[model samples]
Target: MLPFQLAEIVNQGKLVSDEIIINLLSRRLEEGEEKGELGFILDGFPRTMRQAEILEGVTNIDLVINLKLREEALVARCLGRRMCSQCGENFNVASIDIEGENGGAPMYLPPLLPPPQCESKLITRADDTEEVVKNRLRVYHDLTEPVEGFYKARQKLLEFNIPGGISESWRKLLEALNIEDSDNMRSAAA
Candidate 1:
């Protein structure tokens, strides 16, 4: 677990050292193994080549999903993100609508609106500012993007392009994972 000080730094869009992340992950994975969990999923991890090398030393990763989105849309979405100060629930106020260019698929992700009570308590993250988001994107392109190639070389990466809002993209994601959507299953049974 990151100390409160390190967590504060992370909240400001700064990355902690690879040693800190690797140590935390090692302990968590060990605990999961002790419990005999079938598997685990990590989001937004192995952000550096060093971290990937360390992970490879410990366990065999079966698959890695790389979700792709346009940088413009990503910036807008990040800027629109909000959290309730009281309940800490997340929401997005941005409604993205980007036109398809050069045969690329058009993208639209509607904002995740909050309830009436949460609306009054909404707070933007410090790191969600346009400047900070852009900086983080720059850092990702410089440091983390290469991790995609690392997984690709191992034949373990699945590039998934998010085509639209949750409903549309989620269905496509289920298809990619070869998993049946529960809603479809229920409708068929009915």
Candidate 2:
């Protein structure tokens, strides 16, 4: 698996430790810069303030979008996630329960939402379990809060609160980012 191979490389270790990925990324940027493309979007990378500084030195981040949802809300939303076994659709248990999933405590178990598309194959990730998700969130808060602050101090951050529902939340998110049309997003994703 890709993760397994990454583990081998990580375990083998090198003189460069935490910044190894950044070094590789800078190499990638150099390659992309040679092309006519505008630039690259680095998501889930540069997690630390140091990494942010390193990135700032290389290029300007036009917008740093932050989803400002309460931790309890996030925990509920994340802990209640259920996905189709064959297809990769995320259904929020805190809001709309899927039709099939039976995970989490009785108080927390969310109803499964059937696959959005008729394509039948859906699966939940192993790490989506409650304990794993809770720990993941704790780590996320610890790591990402600083990254958020890093941008906040530079006034490069744009935050959008999660609205009352998914539909509204997504609409607000796009509005915060100034995305005027969904067609462009769908086409880009496609």
Candidate 3:
């Protein structure tokens, strides 16, 4: 399922059935496999043990990158995220400036300025509220965290709790995956 589809389900404070999630993922995987795709960076699949078991039947997964973050940080991060209504591009509150304080409150000015070539405004997803984010994290810890143990038992989990932001994390990920910065780095990663 697309992020928006999953977001809608999650925003309603409900979970999509594992079977449906697995089926959607399987279809996408099948298509990628047909095209000779060697590796995939699955964002949020196999959240449950059953889903992980089903995945074993599909393809050989070498590594599972688990990014461990504090609950408070996760809540803040989710609350900060905004997306372009037109193109679905993501922007974060940390990167954007918010004017006013106290009761006056929250006037956003994205550092990207005018978002060149795009006419539509960026908006927060309905589910990105603090309460919903906390609930989602609760669900993750209760159900999805077990998947970490599943991979750990198989010696396939590479867990990290890094303090640095995206660039540092991306560098670490490329190192873990053993991907090199060759002339075709962009195409190879794609």
- Point to the candidate with the largest lDDT: 1
Badly placed stretches (over 4 Å) of model 3 are 1-8, 95-120, 183-190
Alpha carbon lDDT of each predicted model: 0.89, 0.64, 0.73
lDDT of 2 by residue, 41-84 (tens): 78766666777878888777877877665556566676666676
* Cα displacement (Å) at residue 128, model 1: 1.1
Candidate 2 Cα misplacement greater than 4 A, ranges: 5-17, 82-112, 116-121, 182-190
TM-scores of the candidates are: 0.93, 0.65, 0.74
Candidate 1 regions exceeding 4 Å error are: 187-190
Clashes of each: 0, 15, 0
TM-score of 2: 0.65
Best first by lDDT, ranked: 1, 3, 2
Compared with the true structure, what per-residue lDDT tens digits does model 3 show for residues 1-190? Answer: 6788877787776789877777787898899889998778888777888889988987788888887755555666678777878887877665433444465433332333336554357788888777887887888788877899999999999887643466655676677678875645776878
Q: Give the distance in Å from residue 151's predicted Cα in candidate 3 to where it truly belongs.
A: 0.9
Q: What is candidate 2's local distance difference test score?
A: 0.64
lDDT per residue for candidate 1 within 1-190, as digits (tens), equals 4488786876777788888778888899999999998899998888888888889998889999989888999999999999999999999999999989999878889999999999899999877888878888888878877898999999999999999999999899999999999988999999
